[model samples]
Target: MATKLLTFVIFLAGVLPAADAAIDIGKVLGEHREFSLFSSLLSSTGVARATNSREAVTVLAPNNTAVVAALRGVPRGADTRALLSDVLSLHVILEYIDADKLELLAEGRSGDGTRVTTLLQANGKAQGRYAGFVHISVGEEEYDRITFTSGAIGSPWNATFEKAIAQLPPSVSVLQVSGFIFPPGVIPPQPRARQTSMPPAPSPAPGPMAHPPRQPLLPAPAPAPPRPTPATPNLTNTPPPSGNVIPIPIPSVDGGMNATLPSAAGHRVASSWGVAGLLFGLVVCLIWSL
Candidate 1:
């Protein structure tokens, strides 16, 4: 009857989240020098308050050295505070799980993983829903090795379950791990580029009708203007001078006929005409004197 009663007590202890007195995970971890790093960070991130909840919890504790190693790669500064806080939350499991229970859970789950809720309800991509879910599984080569981290956020960043550090019945339990469980938001390092071979593209066929490379068109030279031809008198169509031609006076420029400048030939012709009239007048006077 005592054995049965003890079993029942143990079962109740596993079922409970945390007793009111057992909630201070910080104080418990603070007592141990090895867990001091995790303890301080838990308090800073307020994830330690998760142990004070009415729900049961399991903490996968990484030692101070392990904590330092995990954080070593992370560049230090205030910007990483929220990231560190979320990372700290990843160490915590909301459900009460002893080392033996975690071992049993590892069985039959060869391919698919199991999810464990953490203290960070707001740490994932979604709002209000719990984001930090650690994927639990047993290592293949090492049967005993249990891995805890999420596939939703997979990586070179992973935390391995080492051993159970401490256990408090009906409340909080602490397990030591090899590394820190990285959160979902942090980006991972880029993978190296791989060399690959591909067939080259075929060149365009060069032949008649194929389009040539475009060249800018120079502006066309301005057209040359037509040259002016001088006016020539039509000598073939001109009439010989008659007696009536002498009496016809040259018209004024106002009469609408354009004035033409006489050449040297015209001046010689006028002088010759005046001399012939004078000789004819003298002959007529001598005839009249006889």
Candidate 2:
């Protein structure tokens, strides 16, 4: 039948693109927060979880007085909940991208500027330093800040800024990127190490002029000494001289070939060393017939 209905139409075209990616993450969490927790932390610091799930997002949020003055030089307790969860996971960003994808990621990017990456991250690193510069003159709603540099030396990324205030959300706002667009030794881009892709160079084994029979190289001579040969004697007392034949050898095809035939109840089972010496001779003949 048309190859099992073309393998059930290639398994329903691979289950309709994961059922349309679970209905677009339930219509992007019921329409926007832009993947909130500052954009589901740039896809939880793994980077662009499907580019912040499309549809348009331009978060410049950082309000509760810029998240309480970006956590006033942290230090309240338990190491201020791991240094404000790595300075609020490097300020989240995966892209639902608005403000024209932050001016095409800031045109030709210059120094003291570029380093935008977030999905926040911890121990294995990367929880902040997403300051790729895009400060469009503060208020009047043109806010878009992504700045960096806060509490440095031996990295104390305020524990992703107290895990971005315990993963905010009640409608999203978080502020405090103070004095109009960051610069005091600008910080935020830490979650670094990720590179990975390199495994593709193994296809050269076909040469010998693509198979023919060319095996020639010979030049290598001299080195032959040890001589002496002449001793044959003990003929086993000269015997056996009537009807001598001895031939029987046929085995080959890589020896003992069978072409499938083993199961006669797996040759009557019993061999873990003959069933442990027949259960230790039936427990020593049941303790000598008790």
- What are the TM-scores, per candidate, against the unseen true structure? 0.51, 0.19
Error (Å) of candidate 2 at residue 140 is 14
Off by over 4 Å in 2: 1-30, 33-37, 42-86, 89-187, 191-203, 208-290
Whole-model lDDT values for every prediction? 0.68, 0.38
Predicted structure 1, TM vs. truth: 0.51
Query: What tens digits encode model 1's per-residue C-alpha lDDT throughout 1-290?
Result: 99999999999999988635647787778777999988887887677775566357888888989776656555556757766666666667778888788876666365545777776653453222234677687765666688776545443337678787778765778888887766555543223345477779899887688687887698778899988898675467454445323332233767653333234445666677689989999999999999
lDDT per residue for candidate 2 within 1-290, as digits (tens), equals 99999999999998877522211322333344422443343344333344344332223444344444444444455544444444444443323444333344433254222334343322244422423323222122222433333222222122111112221232222332332223224343334355599889999987566567766698557678767787665367553342442222333498863333124323433234468778999999999999
lDDT of 2: 0.38
Q: All predictions: root-mean-square deviation over Cα? A: 20.4, 40.8
